[model samples]
Target: MSKRGSGLFFAILLAFALILSACGNNNGGGNQGGGSEGGKSSGGGDNKTLSLLTGGTGGTYYPLGGSMAQIISDETDYNANAQSSGASAENMQALKNGEADIAFSQTDIAAYALNGELMFKDNKVDNVKAIGTLYPETVQIITTKGSGINSVEDLKGKSVSVGAPGSGVNANAQQILEIHGLSFDDIKAQSLSFDESTDGIQSGSIDAAFITAGTPTAAVESLSAQKEIRVIPIADDKIKQLIEKYPYYAEDTVPKGTYKIPEDVKTVAVKAMLVVRDDMPEDDVYAITKAIFENTDKITHAKGKLIKAETALDGIGDLPLHPGAEKYFSEKGVQK
Candidate 1:
C-alpha cells in the first residue's frame, strides 16, 4: 500500500506542475501579442500608421487625401490611411483632440481656427500646423439660368444655399455678403451640403448657392449637366474689398468653358491645404511632405495637378508651418 500510494501521488503532482507551467507561458505570450497589436494601432511602432482626415466622399478633399495617403504609404516608412471626415473646422478639432495626425483643410478655415474667429470663436485650435497650401478653393456663387440673380446684390430676398453650417464655405458666404452690403438677414439663407445645394437648385427649392471648392467642382458640374447654371461673377470692386478684409482670399476666375458659361466669371478663393499635428516628429513630417510634393504627378484628382512645390505657400496666411514641411520647403528654396 505504501509504494503504490506514493507513486500515484507523485504522478498527480507532476501533472499539476505541467499544467501551471503551460498556463504561465500562455499568459506571457498573450501580453506580448497584445503589446504588438497596440503598437501598430497607435502609430507607436517602426511601421507607424497615421490617420489622415479628409472630407466627405463627394468633395475634392476625400479623393485628393486618398491619393496623398497612398503616396505617403508607398514612398515612406510610415503608413497612412485617409478617413472621410467633416472637413476644415472638424478636421482642426480632430487634430486638437489627438484623433488625427493629418488633415485637409481650407486656408481661410485654418486661419479662423488658429485665431479663434468666425466659426471657431473663443475656441482656438493651437495644435495644428500647416504642411502646405495645395490649391485654390474658388468661391462659386451658382444659380440656374433665368433665376434673375445676376450679382451678389440680386441675391436679396431669394433662397440661397450658404454651405453647410459652421463650414468655411459659410464663412466665405457671410464675408462676401457683408462686403456686398448684405447679410444673411438679407437673403433666405439655407445651410446645405454641396450635393444638397445642387439638388435644391434642381428642384427649384433653392434659388442659388455659395459653393467654395476647386474650379470645375463635381457638384456644380453635375448640376450644370441637367440645367444650364450660371456662375455669377463677383464684381471686381467687391473682390478688392473682400481681399482687403480677408487677406487669405485671392481673386480667381472661373474660365468660361469651365462651366459652359458665356464669359469668364470673377470670384475669390481660399486655398486647400494640408495640416498636421504639431507634435509629429520632424523627420516623419519631413518625409511625409517630401513624399507628397515629389509625387504630385501620381495624384489622379484634377486638383492634384495644381499641387506644386512652387505654390505651396500661396495662401498659408498666419498659420504656422510644421517644422517638417518648413524643412522640406526650405531645402527646395521655397520661400514662406
Candidate 2:
C-alpha cells in the first residue's frame, strides 16, 4: 500500500476506535436504563431525585418518611429516599437549600418559616410550600404520677424538657409555657429530644416534658409501660387562649387508653405537614400529593394510623399550598 493511503487508513481506524469506546461507556449505565426498575433516570442530568427529609431515627417522621419514599418510588417514576434529619426546622432549611425534595414538618413551624417568626426570626424561607397536612400531634405535658404537675400552671419552678434545640417541638413547648404565663426563667428548661427527654424522666432528672407527638407516642408509651405517668390536661380556657392566638393549635383528645391515663385527657395539637420547594415541577408534585392521599392505606399500614383524604385540607394553616397540591385537592372536590 502507498504511504499516503496507509496514513489515511490509520486515521479512519483511530476514529472508529474512539466511537467504539464511546459506545462502551454509554452501555455502562449511562442514559439508557440507568435507574433501577421503577426508579428515575438519575444518571442523566435531566431527571430529578426525590429525597424525603424526616426526623431522627427513633421518631415517627423517620418511619413514615421511609414508607412515603417507597410509595413514591412504587407509584411514580421518581427515585425517592428517606433521610434522617432534625425534623421541622432543619427540614425547612434542607428544602430551602435545595438539598432535599420533600420533608415532614409541623404546621406551626411551616408557618414560621413562611412568615419569619420564632426560630426563623428575621430571615424567612419563602420557597417552602405545603403538600398537605398529615395527622395531628398532641402536645402532651407528661410527668410521673406523683410529680404534682397537674396542669400547665404547675410547671412553674420545675425542671422541664422543652425539646431539642432548633426543633419545632421546642417552639411548641415555649408557646405552651408562655401561654400559661410562665417563662424559661420560671422553670429549669432542658433541651432534649423525645427519647432523651423520656430518658431524663426515667432517670428522675427531669420533672416534666412537653412532648408533641401522635397519641400512643412511642416514647410516652414505653414510659407508661414501665412506669406510671400522668398526662396533664390543658384546660378549656387555656386551649381557647392558645387557639385564639395561634389558629394552628387545634383541640385534640388523648383517649383514656392512650398511655397510663385512665380518663381521656384534653390537649392542644399541631398538624404534621408534608412540604416541598416552590420550584418543584407542578405535575410531579401533583402526582405525589395524589399518590399519597389516594394510597392512604399504604401510609396507614406503614405508620399504624388512619390518614383520611378528606381531612387533608382541614388544618393546613396560612402556609401557601403548592400549586400542584392545590390542583390535586381541587380535583378531589376538596378546597383549601
Candidate 3:
C-alpha cells in the first residue's frame, strides 16, 4: 500500500476505536464508577466504578461518603465517586434512577422508601435494601441563648429552618412538630442546609432550626463559638411515645461533652444506613459491605465515628438486610 494510504487507514482505525470506547463508557450507567473491588469492568475490561450517593456537603452523610469512597479507592482498584444530593430522600431517588450504585441514608428514610411509606407515599422504592447501620443522628435544635426559646413550645411564632424538604432531617422535624401541634406555619419555615441555617441565624434571617447530626457538627460548633447556642431538650415523655410508634427511632443522648451543654441532652435518634439496589450482584455487594466494615477507621474519622463495625454495626434500619450483606455478617459472626 502507498505510505499516504497507510497513514489514512491508521487514522480511521484510531477514530473508530475512540468511538467504540466512548460508546462503552456511555453504557456503564452508575455502576461504571469503578470503586467496587469485585465490580464488573467496562467493555468486558477488568475495570469497575461505583457511584455512592449521600447528602448535602453541609452534613455528615457527605463526609462519611467521602471517607468510604477514599477507602474503596485505596483498598481496591475501582474508581469510587461520592455524589452529593439532598440527603436521604434525594439519595434514594438517585439510587432508583440508577444514578448511584450505593447510598448513605437515614434508617427512617430508608424504611419509608422501601415500604413506600411517608415521604415516599404514592411511589415505592421496593428495590432498596440495607447493608448496615452506621451511626445515630441526634435531633439538634439550637436557638440563640437569649431568644427566650427555652422549650420546644417556645418555638411558636419564631422563624425556623427545618431543613430542606424530602430530607430525612426535615421529615423527622415535621413529624415531631405535627405531634407537638406545630406546622411550618407556626414558625416561618426555611428549607436550608445546616450551613445555610447557621448563616441564617447569625445574620438574623431566622431564629432556630432543627439540626439532626452526629455532634459536634461544624456548623453548630462554629455558631456556638461566635454566640451562645443553646441546645433544646426534647420533651422526654413526648419523645417516648414517638419512639414507640416509630420503630426506627430510639432514645439517644448527645452527651454533655459533645456540645457545651449543662448535662446529657436527650433526644430522639435514628440510625444512618448504608444501602444498595437489590439487583446488584451478590458478590459485588458483599465486597462493598465487607470493605466498609474492614475499613471502619476511615469512616469513623471522616465526619464522626459513625461506623464502629465491631461495636456499633447494628442493623437498626427498617429495611431488610441485603442478602450479600447478610453473608458478610454471618461469616463474621456478628449478631444482627
> What TM-score, over all chains together, does every model reach?
0.85, 0.84, 0.83
Candidate scoring better on lDDT of 1 and 2: 1
Clashing pairs in 3: 32-49, 33-49, 33-50, 34-48, 34-49, 34-50, 34-78, 34-79, 35-78, 35-79
lDDT of 3 by residue, 40-150 (tens): 333234446778987767677787788899877666545689988787888887888777888988888888887888878877887777888877877888788788888
Model 2 scores what on Cα lDDT?
0.83
- Residue-pair clashes per prediction, in order, are 0, 0, 10
For TM-score, candidate 1 versus 2, the one ahead is 1
Best by TM-score: 1
Full-model lDDT for every candidate: 0.87, 0.83, 0.77
Q: Name the candidate, 1 or 3, with the larger lDDT value.
A: 1
Runs of candidate 2 with Cα error greater than 4 angstroms are 1-48, 300-305
Residue-level lDDT of model 1, residues 1-336, one tens digit each, is 699999999999999999999997666343321212112223323666889998866578887888998988887766789998878888999999999999999998998899888878977999989999999999999998889999899999999999777888889999999998999999999998888899999999999999888877877888888999999999989999999988889999999888778888889998999999999888778888888998999998998889999999978867899988898899999987
Candidate 1, overall lDDT?
A: 0.87
Q: Least accurate stretch of 10 residues (summed lDDT) in model 2? A: 32-41
